[model samples]
Target: MNAPLTSDASPRLEDFPYRISDNVRFADLDPNQHVNNAVYATYFETGRVTLVKDRSHGLMPEGLSWMLVRLDMHFRSELRWPGTIEMGLGLVKFGRTSVTLDQVVFSEDKCVASAQAVTVLIEEATRKPTRLTSEIVRNFQPWRRRGVNVASPKF
Candidate 1:
Protein backbone atom coordinates (compact mmCIF):
# COMPACT_ATOMS: atom_id res chain seq x y z
CA MET A 1 0.00 0.00 0.00
CA ASN A 2 2.93 2.32 -0.27
CA ALA A 3 3.33 4.91 -2.99
CA PRO A 4 4.91 3.84 -6.24
CA LEU A 5 8.66 3.94 -6.45
CA THR A 6 9.40 6.65 -8.98
CA SER A 7 12.74 7.01 -10.70
CA ASP A 8 13.89 8.93 -7.65
CA ALA A 9 12.28 6.68 -5.07
CA SER A 10 14.80 5.22 -2.68
CA PRO A 11 12.89 2.23 -1.41
CA ARG A 12 13.49 0.71 2.00
CA LEU A 13 12.59 -2.74 3.30
CA GLU A 14 9.49 -1.26 4.94
CA ASP A 15 8.33 -0.02 1.55
CA PHE A 16 7.95 -3.56 0.28
CA PRO A 17 4.86 -5.51 1.33
CA TYR A 18 5.80 -8.86 -0.18
CA ARG A 19 8.62 -10.91 1.33
CA ILE A 20 9.63 -14.58 0.86
CA SER A 21 12.24 -16.34 2.93
CA ASP A 22 14.22 -19.25 1.46
CA ASN A 23 16.98 -21.38 2.88
CA VAL A 24 20.47 -21.40 1.35
CA ARG A 25 20.70 -25.05 0.34
CA PHE A 26 23.88 -27.02 -0.19
CA ALA A 27 23.01 -27.40 -3.84
CA ASP A 28 23.04 -23.63 -4.23
CA LEU A 29 26.63 -23.23 -3.12
CA ASP A 30 29.63 -22.76 -5.39
CA PRO A 31 33.23 -23.85 -4.98
CA ASN A 32 33.79 -20.90 -2.65
CA GLN A 33 31.00 -22.25 -0.40
CA HIS A 34 29.00 -19.04 -0.66
CA VAL A 35 25.77 -18.95 -2.61
CA ASN A 36 26.45 -19.10 -6.33
CA ASN A 37 26.06 -15.91 -8.32
CA ALA A 38 23.67 -17.52 -10.76
CA VAL A 39 21.49 -18.95 -8.00
CA TYR A 40 20.37 -15.47 -7.05
CA ALA A 41 18.23 -15.31 -10.18
CA THR A 42 16.32 -18.35 -9.03
CA TYR A 43 15.87 -16.76 -5.62
CA PHE A 44 14.41 -13.70 -7.28
CA GLU A 45 12.17 -15.95 -9.31
CA THR A 46 10.83 -17.40 -6.08
CA GLY A 47 9.86 -13.92 -4.95
CA ARG A 48 8.03 -13.22 -8.20
CA VAL A 49 6.18 -16.52 -8.09
CA THR A 50 5.11 -15.98 -4.50
CA LEU A 51 3.96 -12.47 -5.30
CA VAL A 52 1.83 -13.62 -8.20
CA LYS A 53 0.42 -16.52 -6.20
CA ASP A 54 -0.53 -14.34 -3.27
CA ARG A 55 -1.86 -11.43 -5.31
CA SER A 56 -3.66 -13.31 -8.08
CA HIS A 57 -4.41 -16.47 -6.14
CA GLY A 58 -3.29 -18.40 -9.21
CA LEU A 59 -6.09 -16.90 -11.27
CA MET A 60 -3.96 -15.46 -14.02
CA PRO A 61 -5.79 -13.90 -16.93
CA GLU A 62 -6.46 -16.22 -19.82
CA GLY A 63 -3.90 -16.34 -22.64
CA LEU A 64 -1.63 -14.12 -20.59
CA SER A 65 1.63 -14.90 -18.85
CA TRP A 66 4.63 -12.90 -17.78
CA MET A 67 7.83 -13.09 -19.76
CA LEU A 68 11.16 -11.93 -18.59
CA VAL A 69 12.73 -9.32 -20.83
CA ARG A 70 15.62 -8.02 -18.76
CA LEU A 71 17.32 -8.51 -15.44
CA ASP A 72 19.88 -6.36 -13.58
CA MET A 73 21.40 -7.56 -10.37
CA HIS A 74 24.04 -6.29 -7.95
CA PHE A 75 25.93 -8.54 -5.58
CA ARG A 76 26.48 -6.68 -2.37
CA SER A 77 27.70 -9.49 -0.14
CA GLU A 78 28.04 -13.25 0.00
CA LEU A 79 25.51 -15.63 1.58
CA ARG A 80 26.45 -18.69 3.61
CA TRP A 81 24.73 -22.01 4.18
CA PRO A 82 22.38 -22.93 7.02
CA GLY A 83 20.85 -19.47 6.80
CA THR A 84 17.63 -17.94 5.53
CA ILE A 85 17.46 -15.62 2.56
CA GLU A 86 14.85 -12.93 3.01
CA MET A 87 13.72 -11.88 -0.46
CA GLY A 88 11.64 -8.77 -0.83
CA LEU A 89 9.68 -7.61 -3.89
CA GLY A 90 7.79 -4.48 -4.94
CA LEU A 91 6.19 -3.18 -8.11
CA VAL A 92 8.29 -0.17 -8.89
CA LYS A 93 6.95 0.67 -12.33
CA PHE A 94 3.91 -0.09 -14.50
CA GLY A 95 3.99 0.21 -18.26
CA ARG A 96 1.47 -0.32 -21.02
CA THR A 97 2.57 -3.93 -21.39
CA SER A 98 5.25 -4.42 -18.78
CA VAL A 99 6.11 -3.86 -15.13
CA THR A 100 9.45 -3.34 -13.47
CA LEU A 101 9.96 -5.27 -10.27
CA ASP A 102 12.59 -4.40 -7.70
CA GLN A 103 13.82 -7.05 -5.32
CA VAL A 104 16.42 -7.58 -2.65
CA VAL A 105 17.72 -10.73 -0.98
CA PHE A 106 18.80 -10.40 2.61
CA SER A 107 20.51 -12.70 5.06
CA GLU A 108 18.93 -12.08 8.44
CA ASP A 109 18.24 -8.45 7.52
CA LYS A 110 21.64 -7.99 5.92
CA CYS A 111 21.17 -7.43 2.22
CA VAL A 112 23.29 -9.76 0.11
CA ALA A 113 22.00 -9.04 -3.36
CA SER A 114 19.38 -7.09 -5.29
CA ALA A 115 17.78 -7.10 -8.74
CA GLN A 116 15.49 -5.16 -11.05
CA ALA A 117 13.54 -7.09 -13.63
CA VAL A 118 11.33 -6.09 -16.52
CA THR A 119 8.49 -8.55 -17.03
CA VAL A 120 6.17 -8.24 -19.96
CA LEU A 121 2.71 -9.66 -20.52
CA ILE A 122 2.50 -11.12 -23.99
CA GLU A 123 -0.14 -13.00 -25.91
CA GLU A 124 0.57 -16.72 -25.74
CA ALA A 125 0.15 -17.23 -29.48
CA THR A 126 1.50 -14.12 -31.15
CA ARG A 127 3.93 -13.10 -28.44
CA LYS A 128 2.79 -9.52 -28.77
CA PRO A 129 2.52 -7.10 -25.90
CA THR A 130 -0.85 -6.92 -24.20
CA ARG A 131 -2.30 -3.81 -22.77
CA LEU A 132 -2.87 -3.58 -19.04
CA THR A 133 -6.58 -4.04 -18.66
CA SER A 134 -8.75 -2.97 -15.75
CA GLU A 135 -8.89 -6.51 -14.50
CA ILE A 136 -5.14 -6.81 -14.71
CA VAL A 137 -4.74 -3.54 -12.84
CA ARG A 138 -7.27 -4.53 -10.20
CA ASN A 139 -5.68 -7.87 -9.44
CA PHE A 140 -2.29 -6.23 -8.85
CA GLN A 141 -3.51 -3.29 -6.76
CA PRO A 142 -1.63 -4.60 -3.74
CA TRP A 143 1.61 -3.74 -5.52
CA ARG A 144 0.36 -1.27 -8.10
CA ARG A 145 2.22 1.92 -9.04
CA ARG A 146 3.13 4.14 -11.96
CA GLY A 147 5.82 3.00 -14.35
CA VAL A 148 9.09 4.85 -14.33
CA ASN A 149 12.14 4.98 -16.52
CA VAL A 150 14.58 2.19 -15.81
CA ALA A 151 18.23 2.82 -15.06
CA SER A 152 20.78 1.19 -17.30
CA PRO A 153 22.34 -1.93 -15.85
CA LYS A 154 25.92 -1.89 -14.63
CA PHE A 155 26.57 -5.38 -15.92
Candidate 2:
Protein backbone atom coordinates (compact mmCIF):
# COMPACT_ATOMS: atom_id res chain seq x y z
CA MET A 1 0.00 0.00 0.00
CA ASN A 2 1.09 3.60 -0.59
CA ALA A 3 1.32 6.23 2.11
CA PRO A 4 -1.32 8.92 1.89
CA LEU A 5 -0.52 12.54 1.20
CA THR A 6 -0.82 14.25 4.55
CA SER A 7 -2.64 17.52 5.16
CA ASP A 8 0.28 19.16 6.93
CA ALA A 9 2.46 18.70 3.83
CA SER A 10 0.57 18.95 0.60
CA PRO A 11 2.32 18.38 -2.70
CA ARG A 12 3.05 21.18 -5.13
CA LEU A 13 1.62 21.03 -8.62
CA GLU A 14 5.03 21.66 -10.15
CA ASP A 15 6.26 18.36 -8.74
CA PHE A 16 4.06 16.62 -11.23
CA PRO A 17 5.58 16.32 -14.70
CA TYR A 18 2.42 15.79 -16.72
CA ARG A 19 -0.41 18.32 -16.48
CA ILE A 20 -3.69 19.20 -18.20
CA SER A 21 -6.57 21.57 -17.67
CA ASP A 22 -10.27 20.74 -17.41
CA ASN A 23 -13.50 22.53 -16.66
CA VAL A 24 -15.75 21.91 -13.67
CA ARG A 25 -19.11 21.14 -15.23
CA PHE A 26 -22.35 22.09 -13.53
CA ALA A 27 -23.38 18.45 -13.80
CA ASP A 28 -20.44 17.49 -11.61
CA LEU A 29 -21.92 19.27 -8.60
CA ASP A 30 -23.93 17.41 -6.02
CA PRO A 31 -26.90 18.68 -4.00
CA ASN A 32 -24.39 20.26 -1.64
CA GLN A 33 -23.19 22.51 -4.48
CA HIS A 34 -19.65 21.20 -4.59
CA VAL A 35 -18.00 18.81 -7.00
CA ASN A 36 -19.08 15.34 -6.05
CA ASN A 37 -16.47 12.97 -4.65
CA ALA A 38 -16.97 10.57 -7.55
CA VAL A 39 -16.10 13.29 -10.06
CA TYR A 40 -12.64 13.60 -8.59
CA ALA A 41 -11.89 10.04 -9.71
CA THR A 42 -12.75 11.01 -13.26
CA TYR A 43 -10.45 13.99 -13.01
CA PHE A 44 -7.61 11.76 -11.93
CA GLU A 45 -8.39 9.29 -14.68
CA THR A 46 -8.18 12.02 -17.27
CA GLY A 47 -4.66 12.83 -16.19
CA ARG A 48 -3.46 9.24 -16.32
CA VAL A 49 -5.21 8.33 -19.52
CA THR A 50 -4.02 11.38 -21.41
CA LEU A 51 -0.45 10.65 -20.51
CA VAL A 52 -0.41 6.92 -21.21
CA LYS A 53 -2.62 6.84 -24.29
CA ASP A 54 -0.81 9.61 -26.08
CA ARG A 55 1.05 7.86 -28.87
CA SER A 56 3.73 10.51 -29.32
CA HIS A 57 4.91 9.81 -25.78
CA GLY A 58 5.66 6.20 -26.71
CA LEU A 59 4.45 4.88 -23.34
CA MET A 60 2.02 2.39 -24.77
CA PRO A 61 3.18 -0.41 -26.99
CA GLU A 62 1.28 -2.52 -29.46
CA GLY A 63 -0.39 -5.67 -28.14
CA LEU A 64 -0.27 -4.37 -24.55
CA SER A 65 -2.62 -2.34 -22.40
CA TRP A 66 -2.62 -0.86 -18.94
CA MET A 67 -5.10 -1.93 -16.28
CA LEU A 68 -5.86 0.02 -13.16
CA VAL A 69 -5.25 -2.10 -10.11
CA ARG A 70 -5.66 0.38 -7.27
CA LEU A 71 -6.48 4.00 -6.56
CA ASP A 72 -6.46 5.85 -3.20
CA MET A 73 -7.66 9.45 -3.15
CA HIS A 74 -7.62 12.21 -0.56
CA PHE A 75 -9.95 15.17 -0.80
CA ARG A 76 -8.54 18.28 0.79
CA SER A 77 -10.92 21.15 0.05
CA GLU A 78 -14.29 21.76 -1.52
CA LEU A 79 -14.17 22.30 -5.29
CA ARG A 80 -16.96 24.49 -6.57
CA TRP A 81 -18.36 24.96 -10.05
CA PRO A 82 -17.69 27.82 -12.48
CA GLY A 83 -13.98 27.03 -12.44
CA THR A 84 -11.27 25.19 -14.30
CA ILE A 85 -9.01 22.59 -12.80
CA GLU A 86 -5.41 21.71 -13.49
CA MET A 87 -4.69 18.05 -13.10
CA GLY A 88 -1.21 16.62 -12.67
CA LEU A 89 0.35 13.18 -12.69
CA GLY A 90 3.82 11.89 -11.83
CA LEU A 91 5.39 8.51 -11.96
CA VAL A 92 6.66 7.66 -8.48
CA LYS A 93 7.59 3.99 -8.56
CA PHE A 94 8.10 1.28 -11.13
CA GLY A 95 7.57 -2.44 -10.63
CA ARG A 96 8.06 -5.34 -12.96
CA THR A 97 4.48 -5.33 -14.13
CA SER A 98 3.01 -2.26 -12.44
CA VAL A 99 3.73 1.45 -12.14
CA THR A 100 2.69 3.67 -9.25
CA LEU A 101 1.63 7.24 -9.96
CA ASP A 102 0.88 10.24 -7.79
CA GLN A 103 -1.91 12.45 -9.17
CA VAL A 104 -3.41 15.76 -8.12
CA VAL A 105 -6.18 18.21 -9.01
CA PHE A 106 -5.68 21.90 -8.47
CA SER A 107 -8.11 24.76 -8.76
CA GLU A 108 -6.68 28.27 -8.84
CA ASP A 109 -3.32 27.03 -7.62
CA LYS A 110 -4.80 25.18 -4.64
CA CYS A 111 -4.71 21.43 -4.40
CA VAL A 112 -8.26 20.24 -3.86
CA ALA A 113 -7.55 16.53 -4.15
CA SER A 114 -4.75 14.02 -4.59
CA ALA A 115 -4.42 10.30 -5.24
CA GLN A 116 -2.03 7.40 -5.69
CA ALA A 117 -2.79 4.93 -8.43
CA VAL A 118 -1.28 1.65 -9.50
CA THR A 119 -1.57 0.30 -13.03
CA VAL A 120 -0.37 -3.00 -14.40
CA LEU A 121 0.66 -3.80 -17.94
CA ILE A 122 -1.16 -6.69 -19.52
CA GLU A 123 -1.18 -8.58 -22.77
CA GLU A 124 -4.14 -7.39 -24.82
CA ALA A 125 -4.96 -10.79 -26.21
CA THR A 126 -4.31 -12.96 -23.18
CA ARG A 127 -5.43 -10.42 -20.56
CA LYS A 128 -2.54 -11.49 -18.36
CA PRO A 129 -0.04 -9.32 -16.58
CA THR A 130 3.10 -8.68 -18.56
CA ARG A 131 6.47 -7.39 -17.48
CA LEU A 132 7.18 -3.82 -18.55
CA THR A 133 9.51 -3.66 -21.47
CA SER A 134 12.80 -1.82 -21.14
CA GLU A 135 11.84 0.65 -23.83
CA ILE A 136 8.61 1.44 -22.12
CA VAL A 137 10.37 1.95 -18.82
CA ARG A 138 12.87 4.28 -20.42
CA ASN A 139 10.09 6.25 -22.01
CA PHE A 140 8.59 6.88 -18.58
CA GLN A 141 11.72 8.52 -17.18
CA PRO A 142 10.70 11.97 -18.35
CA TRP A 143 7.37 11.75 -16.53
CA ARG A 144 8.75 10.95 -13.10
CA ARG A 145 7.76 13.08 -10.14
CA ARG A 146 10.27 15.62 -8.89
CA GLY A 147 12.01 15.05 -5.52
CA VAL A 148 11.18 11.35 -5.55
CA ASN A 149 14.03 8.98 -6.19
CA VAL A 150 12.44 6.46 -8.50
CA ALA A 151 14.82 3.56 -8.73
CA SER A 152 15.90 2.27 -12.11
CA PRO A 153 13.46 -0.14 -13.62
CA LYS A 154 14.42 -3.79 -13.21
CA PHE A 155 13.65 -6.09 -16.08
Candidate 3:
Protein backbone atom coordinates (compact mmCIF):
# COMPACT_ATOMS: atom_id res chain seq x y z
CA MET A 1 0.00 0.00 0.00
CA ASN A 2 1.23 3.45 -0.91
CA ALA A 3 0.51 6.67 0.95
CA PRO A 4 -0.82 9.70 -0.91
CA LEU A 5 1.61 12.56 -1.14
CA THR A 6 0.79 16.05 0.02
CA SER A 7 2.02 19.14 -1.65
CA ASP A 8 3.53 22.37 -0.37
CA ALA A 9 2.87 25.30 -2.67
CA SER A 10 4.22 28.83 -2.90
CA PRO A 11 2.14 31.97 -3.09
CA ARG A 12 1.31 33.05 -6.60
CA LEU A 13 0.40 36.43 -8.00
CA GLU A 14 -2.36 36.35 -10.57
CA ASP A 15 -1.94 39.73 -12.24
CA PHE A 16 1.28 41.17 -10.87
CA PRO A 17 4.35 39.66 -9.32
CA TYR A 18 3.27 41.37 -6.11
CA ARG A 19 0.30 43.65 -5.87
CA ILE A 20 0.20 46.67 -3.61
CA SER A 21 -3.35 47.49 -2.62
CA ASP A 22 -2.94 51.19 -1.92
CA ASN A 23 0.04 52.44 -3.79
CA VAL A 24 -0.81 56.03 -4.59
CA ARG A 25 -2.44 58.05 -1.90
CA PHE A 26 -3.75 61.60 -1.83
CA ALA A 27 -0.41 62.89 -0.65
CA ASP A 28 1.47 60.96 -3.31
CA LEU A 29 0.34 63.39 -6.00
CA ASP A 30 2.22 66.34 -7.30
CA PRO A 31 0.67 69.78 -7.86
CA ASN A 32 -0.19 68.57 -11.38
CA GLN A 33 -2.19 65.64 -10.00
CA HIS A 34 0.39 63.20 -11.34
CA VAL A 35 2.74 61.00 -9.39
CA ASN A 36 6.17 62.56 -9.27
CA ASN A 37 9.18 60.92 -10.83
CA ALA A 38 10.72 60.19 -7.44
CA VAL A 39 7.52 58.53 -6.34
CA TYR A 40 7.72 56.11 -9.24
CA ALA A 41 11.03 54.81 -7.98
CA THR A 42 9.56 54.37 -4.54
CA TYR A 43 6.64 52.41 -5.91
CA PHE A 44 8.91 50.19 -7.90
CA GLU A 45 10.96 49.45 -4.82
CA THR A 46 7.85 48.55 -2.91
CA GLY A 47 6.81 46.12 -5.59
CA ARG A 48 10.20 44.50 -5.66
CA VAL A 49 10.10 43.80 -1.94
CA THR A 50 6.67 42.27 -2.18
CA LEU A 51 7.57 40.16 -5.18
CA VAL A 52 10.43 38.55 -3.29
CA LYS A 53 8.70 38.15 0.02
CA ASP A 54 8.13 34.47 -0.59
CA ARG A 55 10.48 33.51 -3.40
CA SER A 56 13.06 36.27 -3.65
CA HIS A 57 15.76 33.82 -2.72
CA GLY A 58 19.48 34.50 -2.71
CA LEU A 59 21.53 37.68 -3.14
CA MET A 60 20.93 38.78 0.44
CA PRO A 61 22.18 36.20 2.88
CA GLU A 62 23.23 36.30 6.53
CA GLY A 63 26.13 38.61 5.80
CA LEU A 64 25.26 39.93 2.39
CA SER A 65 23.02 42.49 0.72
CA TRP A 66 22.27 43.32 -2.86
CA MET A 67 23.77 46.57 -3.96
CA LEU A 68 22.26 48.40 -6.88
CA VAL A 69 25.10 48.96 -9.30
CA ARG A 70 23.04 50.33 -12.19
CA LEU A 71 19.51 51.22 -13.11
CA ASP A 72 18.00 51.76 -16.57
CA MET A 73 14.50 53.17 -16.79
CA HIS A 74 12.16 53.99 -19.67
CA PHE A 75 9.07 56.07 -19.16
CA ARG A 76 6.50 54.92 -21.67
CA SER A 77 3.54 56.76 -20.17
CA GLU A 78 2.37 58.49 -17.02
CA LEU A 79 0.45 57.36 -13.98
CA ARG A 80 -2.02 59.69 -12.38
CA TRP A 81 -3.01 59.96 -8.76
CA PRO A 82 -5.48 57.68 -6.95
CA GLY A 83 -5.09 54.92 -9.51
CA THR A 84 -3.95 51.38 -8.83
CA ILE A 85 -1.14 49.81 -10.80
CA GLU A 86 0.50 46.42 -10.97
CA MET A 87 4.24 45.85 -11.10
CA GLY A 88 5.56 42.79 -12.86
CA LEU A 89 8.87 41.25 -11.80
CA GLY A 90 11.13 39.21 -14.04
CA LEU A 91 14.74 38.11 -14.07
CA VAL A 92 17.07 38.62 -17.00
CA LYS A 93 20.18 37.06 -15.59
CA PHE A 94 21.94 35.86 -12.47
CA GLY A 95 25.69 36.03 -12.42
CA ARG A 96 28.22 34.99 -9.79
CA THR A 97 27.46 37.99 -7.64
CA SER A 98 25.04 40.03 -9.71
CA VAL A 99 21.46 39.82 -10.92
CA THR A 100 19.52 41.78 -13.49
CA LEU A 101 15.88 42.31 -12.75
CA ASP A 102 13.16 43.55 -15.06
CA GLN A 103 10.37 45.54 -13.44
CA VAL A 104 7.39 46.84 -15.37
CA VAL A 105 4.48 48.93 -14.19
CA PHE A 106 1.09 48.70 -15.82
CA SER A 107 -2.18 50.45 -15.25
CA GLU A 108 -5.18 48.60 -16.64
CA ASP A 109 -3.91 47.27 -19.99
CA LYS A 110 -1.35 49.94 -20.75
CA CYS A 111 2.32 49.76 -19.84
CA VAL A 112 3.21 52.82 -17.84
CA ALA A 113 6.92 52.35 -17.16
CA SER A 114 9.74 49.85 -17.33
CA ALA A 115 12.95 49.68 -15.38
CA GLN A 116 16.02 47.45 -15.38
CA ALA A 117 18.26 47.13 -12.40
CA VAL A 118 21.57 45.37 -11.98
CA THR A 119 22.29 44.32 -8.42
CA VAL A 120 25.53 42.92 -7.10
CA LEU A 121 25.91 40.79 -4.04
CA ILE A 122 27.88 42.46 -1.28
CA GLU A 123 29.14 41.22 2.02
CA GLU A 124 27.37 42.89 4.91
CA ALA A 125 30.50 42.98 7.02
CA THR A 126 33.20 43.70 4.46
CA ARG A 127 30.86 45.39 1.99
CA LYS A 128 32.63 43.70 -0.87
CA PRO A 129 31.42 41.59 -3.77
CA THR A 130 30.73 37.92 -3.16
CA ARG A 131 29.77 35.03 -5.36
CA LEU A 132 26.14 34.04 -5.31
CA THR A 133 25.58 30.56 -3.95
CA SER A 134 24.08 27.64 -5.83
CA GLU A 135 20.86 27.84 -3.84
CA ILE A 136 20.06 31.23 -5.30
CA VAL A 137 21.08 30.13 -8.77
CA ARG A 138 18.71 27.18 -8.68
CA ASN A 139 15.78 29.23 -7.43
CA PHE A 140 16.23 31.89 -10.10
CA GLN A 141 16.75 29.39 -12.94
CA PRO A 142 13.03 28.95 -13.44
CA TRP A 143 12.50 32.67 -14.01
CA ARG A 144 15.20 33.06 -16.65
CA ARG A 145 13.62 33.70 -20.01
CA ARG A 146 14.75 31.80 -23.10
CA GLY A 147 17.51 33.32 -25.27
CA VAL A 148 18.64 35.58 -22.48
CA ASN A 149 22.01 34.00 -22.23
CA VAL A 150 23.96 35.58 -19.38
CA ALA A 151 27.52 34.45 -19.41
CA SER A 152 29.43 33.42 -16.33
CA PRO A 153 31.62 36.16 -14.96
CA LYS A 154 35.39 35.87 -15.00
CA PHE A 155 35.79 38.29 -12.14
- lDDT score for residue 1 of model 1: 95
- Model 3 clashing residue pairs (backbone): none
Compare candidates 1 and 3 on lDDT and give the better one.
1
Residue 97 displacement in candidate 3 (angstroms): 1.4
Q: Give the lDDT ranking, best first.
A: 2, 1, 3
| Selected candidate, larger TM-score, 1 vs 3 | 1
Model 2 agreement with the true structure over 93-140: per-residue lDDT tens digits:
999899999999999999999999999999999999999999999999
Sum up the clashes in candidate 1: 1
lDDT score, candidate 1: 0.74
TM-scores for all candidates: the values are 0.80, 0.95, 0.74
TM-score of 2: 0.95
| Residue-by-residue lDDT tens digits, candidate 3, 1-155 | 85542211211234223345445677777888877777777766775665444434553456666777886666767788677877765677777788887766777667677777788878888989989777666666655533346554454
What are the clashing pairs of model 1? 94-147
- Computed on alpha carbons, the lDDT of every model, listed in order, comes to 0.74, 0.93, 0.64
- Backbone clashes for every candidate come to 1, 0, 0
16-73 per-residue lDDT for model 1 (tens digits):
5678778999999999999999999999999887776453454247777788899888
